[model samples]
Target: MSVKKALISVSDKTGLIPFARRLVAAGVQIISTGGTASLLKAEGVPVIGISEVTGFPEILDGRVKTLHPNIHSGLLAVRDSEAHVQQLKDLGIETIDLVVVNLYPFKETIAKPDVTYEDAIENIDIGGPTMLRSAAKNHAFVSVVVDAADYEKVAEEIEANGDTTLETRRKLAAKVFRHTAAYDALISRYLSEQVGELLPESYTVTYEKAQDLRYGENPHQRAAFYREPLSDQLSIGNASQLQGKELSYNNINDADAALAIVREFAEPAVVAIKHSNPCGVGIGADIRSAYQKAYEADPVSIFGGIVAANRPIDRDTALAMKEIFLEIIIAPDFTEEALAVLAEKKNLRLLRISALNEPAKKVDNLFRVAPVAGGALIQDFDYKQLEENEIQVVTDRKPSEEEMAQLKFAWKVVKHVKSNAILLAKDNMTIGVGAGQMNRVGAAKIAIEQAGALASGAVMASDAFFPMGDTVEAAAKAGITAIIQPGGSIRDQESIDACNRAGIAMIFTGTRHFKH
Candidate 1:
């Protein structure tokens, strides 16, 4: 399987000349089209234009090039088959021993702000994918290279053996399919958007590996981080780590939870998260006060937890944070003095994400996917927010103005917590939180116990309707004066009766936020 002729048509020209020169040095004829042919010719490499082989000039605004029968027959011909060889000889078509192609930057083009529909349509490469697929299909005889990163290995293999090995060709062919699949997915997603179809009959998504994490949630598991292309939203995946060790899977998960909770507050706020659950959250006049309140809310649980702030972290907040051991600290920005102080702690992971200051916007069209044993569960993202008008008073005693504000804050915090979640808040700070319990009563009890003396006048928020009156009775015993829940349980009346008996005010949000 010696190399004779190679086709090179690429949009990404990285290492093009060097790779082309290597091929030419090995006595292989180089056939190229458009910019690739011009660049190789300028580099003093002997090149044959695609039109010379196809006997047809590029037409339809350069869309019809490399799609001729001559190119396809050369790439699809089997060397061992006499009939395949005779067909190529009869047509006077040279066999293409290799194909090097990369698709147009369709994802990059659409990512740009204000890109027009016609602009995106024009950038879709027609002949490149066709040639790559043709070469890949006949991988036993022809090798396909879609990634520029494989140039060195490919060149060395050809230089050493006069051709790529079957193994390498097979691997390259697989890569070609994956590359084309992702390209097609991006095109499909874009077209669906154009047609105002948020959820199409079929959904496709592609992600590029970002990094290999140290490990998964447990040390025994392996994991890698990946991200969607052209995502500009505020997220842990897109954040810049300014200092400290690389993030582990748990660190990323906890940091994501912290950021999600902190973003719920528009004012200066801080959220402390442990094991993907918010242990404490606070909103204050400034960042320092917010940090202080959040830390004090659950001092024991905040140890080694991740902290996220909606505002720039100042020196006083840094001083308070330094007093405890923390896994990660994330914020929009940090003051010079604050960074200097926190720099003393060598292992603390610090991240800077300016998008934190911006309001969190819902990505309506994207689906939240969770992998199962044999398949995946896909559904729309929960972007439901609590509106003032959505609140309904269900108890005889109405919530005071102060109680109403704290109830709203508690409701927002509880949404990010795991199922069976309960949050107790006072003065715009979460004094206690219970998450991921097997039963709602157990979660309520845990939150009440954590609040201690703070539970006396605090408002409680439940992620879902109370199943029975036991949770209300537990709240009453802890001295919680106001409660907010979705109020859709079959035993809702029993819980309402319990609230009335305890002289507590209750409100229904009419919407349940059961996060799992």
Candidate 2:
């Protein structure tokens, strides 16, 4: 089929002029609308205004330009059907053989800091999506393009064979649907949030591909990373990789866990993560001391783990880190001397996230999504923390000021641990962590065993309420002084009685942090 007429309308005009010249050189008449037409004419390219093709002036601020039957019939007419061709001839409409279009900057507009609702509404391109859908629906007869990156491929094909191949048109048609679906989804999400409807009856979300990882959790599984558009949180997605090898699936997961824990601290802190669980966490006067405390927390587990720090790394800290086989070291910044010292280990990944220093902000619209067999579980991100007034001492003896501080520190770290979790902390450092066990007592026993002699005088934290008093008994036996847990279980009195019997101080925060 020979190329006859092509419509070109796009917001992103990256390669527009050259591609349009290629189309014009092929003897194809070009029809354009609004700014596209003006730009083409000024660039010495022959162009026909959209009104000339439709014989109707654009109305409603250019919203009613392409909805007319003249444009739709031109795109929808079947070239090989005698009846379709006859219908177009009866209406005196020329067939549109090609369509080049991209939607408005809706995503970019809403991403602005001070974008108004009116501005966002006005930027939603009604005609562009309509024409693209119409063209894509009839892709068997009309070639459709929605991405500027595809201009060269379409231009070369038209220059060679006068039309895109059937396979190319089919692929472009599929891409058009995806593009429009994502655009509409973004608009739907923004409007829903404006009206205070976060999770509507029908939920839709979109993410752009970041990279394809080497493998997933295991070497046999495939994996890739997708990031939300305009993510403002202090996250792994926003971190800059200063050095080292590309991140694998496990590397990204562990790094994210380490980052999340490190963000919980405002002071200088360090968190070491292994297999998506924090093995050690420490708060200190500086980055170097924090790292030392964290390493001493669990020296065995710190090997080959991902380390995240809330402060910049210096030469002394980097020197101490070089002695171990760490997979990744993430910090706010790295001094020149520190970077040079750490560069000796070529395979170590170093990520710098400046947002670590920024104060934490509340994000109401963010959600945590986990996939199941055939669906997903969605919930708001866990940003809940207990205020000082919210803590209730259920035991006969109240926790000392120092023990209360340690309890608060343990509570923060415990929330990030897996289900059935137990943590032992003292002196602003986690001495032992027992996570992902089957029962509360079992978790406490593991934690107590890890802490050994250190368990004496240390505090314990549980992610959820104990179903029985065995966990408190175990904590008392381990010489733990105070404990913190959400107290809502039916057998909560049993645990309280056990704490009173052992003179252990226990506080209820009335909240559960079950991470699964």
Candidate 3:
């Protein structure tokens, strides 16, 4: 039983070559299916095709090759049971010591726009899952490997100890179950979109372990990131920091806001975000021009803020950004010279990502999670994207053409900010933002105070309905001429009355954008 029999099949052939060679040198009987069998044979490893072992020709495009008793019974048998051993001997089945399999590319197959229904159906791997589950259920006797990245690790373990530990086998079994579950989740979520019915509530998702950070939002807490299998989305979860230190939970949260906001502009743009709100944003001719305008929009608030840009970073743009002490900088690409310049500030995080790679659009009303005492809370994320027709103006004066631009910009900026947020905008740039305040009025006061003389001609945007007339009064006193907010509070009439009395025009969007 020196280096007994093992099965290998994978869609991701990352480290399989060297690993298969090592197992061959150890005298393992290599059995594989379809492309994997051909690949191992090409590498000079002695390999047998599953068709040979199963005595069944690969029919229907090689889908029915590995579903026989000879393959699965070996993996599923209990090694220590006399009956299991006698049954295997009676059936002429060799014991399989290992099963390495990664599922078919169902998710990747559907990612193409023109994939046919038959194509998707063909990728639904039946034999692969059967093999994975059979090995996982008999973990005490067989080791299972789902990730190609695990091949080298398992090889190393066997080389060092002559066998994989029971603990390692159990851990690998856990990974196999997770892999099958995630594969099933993709199939279910995809089919749900096809027929438009009540998607069967049975679904699952898998996230690969990314890393354990020093802390979560605070230094005393513990945190780790699990990256989703869908790597095409434009989330901070997909971002790779190319330089500097690891990101804190707060860094990821704020950087996500910055990236989302910068992606909105049709032209080149820059957005500086703090506390999940855009402290400043601008659309201009070049990166430097946009960065300058955004910086001037709210210099005080931009301190230590995360910056996102829509264009490739150049030497001039990086040089201008170097003048500011920022927490993070993100762009699609950074020139070699620019990276060298940015490398000077070793603590600042630099992230590079393609804009086209983000999700097609935000899936509205997705699940939102919040931790609570002794339990956790989950609900739908905010689904309020305002349209011009949904806006109801209550005052006699329609907003001036100039004021309308600022109002729209502020409204968009406030949506990404933490709840109880207030944003003031002028000339399409945020002049001040008050975020994470305990109450609406407190947030309004902070924004106005930050604006100071700048508030005289600014427009204000709020995340939700103001609970009282005091917040409106505060905005008016600070010289805000126009305001946008969700009008669903109990005292909405009073707030509207206060705005009308102050000669400030107000619009009700009937939408709430609460980030927290």
Candidate 4:
């Protein structure tokens, strides 16, 4: 194959002039549209206008320029077939051996703070995608270029071998389809938001790779991080890594879990996470005491775990953290002494996320998406908080004021735990947590055992209703005085009867917080 004619149209003109110059020097005719043609001609590049090739003036505000049969047939026709070549000759259509195009800035335009719907709709590129798709579909003969980063390689290939190789064209075609798919997904997501459809008739999500991690959950697995550009919520993706080496996949996951649990409190709070489960949590008068209490709740589990705080880390907290080995520490800000002290630990991952102080909004519209074997599952975020009126006393005994406070705190912590999950709390701090167990009773037993003597007066919270009376029996044996759960299981009455017999106070939230 030999280079003959090329069509170039782009919104981003980086490296366009030099690329077009190289093509022109190699005896390839340059045909362009609007701004691209004007710029090339100004630079003495000898470009032919698109209207000259199609013999039709651009109409409808330049939206109807490149949709003619002359353009499509030139790009889509089979080059080696007798019928296709004859039809091209009979129709006086020239073959377009190359196409260089990029879509309009729809994502960038919609990302503005106050962009209107009309503004976004107008920026959607129709002719660009149409031409690129046609060229990509016929990539057996026509080479399609969508990214400026490929300019040097493409130009060198053409200059070296007169035309791009079949392998190169196939790769470019695949790239074109992926690019268009992501573009369409962005349009779909934005329109769905405008129409107030959290999940549309057809849902598609697109993400860009942020970085390649050292490994996934294990050292043998490969992994990378991807991020959604439209997400506004405070998340690990947006956190600023102030220090430390590249974070592993497990580190990112654990840090995210810690941040989510820490955000559940309005007052100064600290949460320690290990293996995507909260090992300890505390809310107190100051950040130092909160961290101290959280660490003391389960000092053995806090080793090498990620810690997140909902307040600025002061000098005292830093001093306490320096005494232990921690993988990561994230907070809204750090005092001068704290940062200096933390900086001493060269390998500790330190992240500063400003959104930690800002309250979460758009609860009703936010979604959490998880991928499965065949497809994905999409559901609304579990932002439900424990309201005073929503709590109902189901057992004969009512929780005391102090017990009620601990029950509410435990409920919030339980929401972030994996099912079957159990949490024990006293004085607004988590004493023990058991997560991701196969059975409810197993989770209860693990939590009770971890609490040890602390379980004597601590309140217990279950992420879901107890399926049997065994969990209630176990809690009662451990001297758990108060229990909080959704209370809608088929064996709910059995558990209630067991609690009453043990003289334990129990409350029903009527809302399950299953986090699996």
Residue pairs clashing in model 4 are: none
- With a 3 Å backbone cut-off (N, CA, C), the pairs that clash in candidate 3 are 234-358
lDDT of 3 by residue, 84-113 (tens): 999999988889898888888898898787
All candidates' lDDT scores? 0.91, 0.92, 0.82, 0.91
Those runs of model 2 whose alpha carbons end farther than 4 Å from true positions after fitting are none
Better of 1 and 3 by lDDT: 1
Candidate 1 residue-wise lDDT, 63-124, digit = tens? 88998999999999889999988988887988999999998999989999999999999988
In model 4, which range of ten residues has the least summed lDDT?
Answer: 357-366
Superposed by TM-score, candidate 4 places the C-alpha of residue 361 at a distance from the truth, in angstroms, of 3.7
Find the candidate with the highest lDDT and give its number.
2
Give per-residue lDDT, candidate 1, residue 406: 93
Candidate 1 weakest ten by summed lDDT: 357-366
Q: What are the models' TM-scores? A: 0.97, 0.97, 0.87, 0.95
Please, what's the RMSD in Å of model 1? Answer: 1.4
Model 4, 130-175: lDDT tens digits are 9999999999999999999888888998999989999999999999
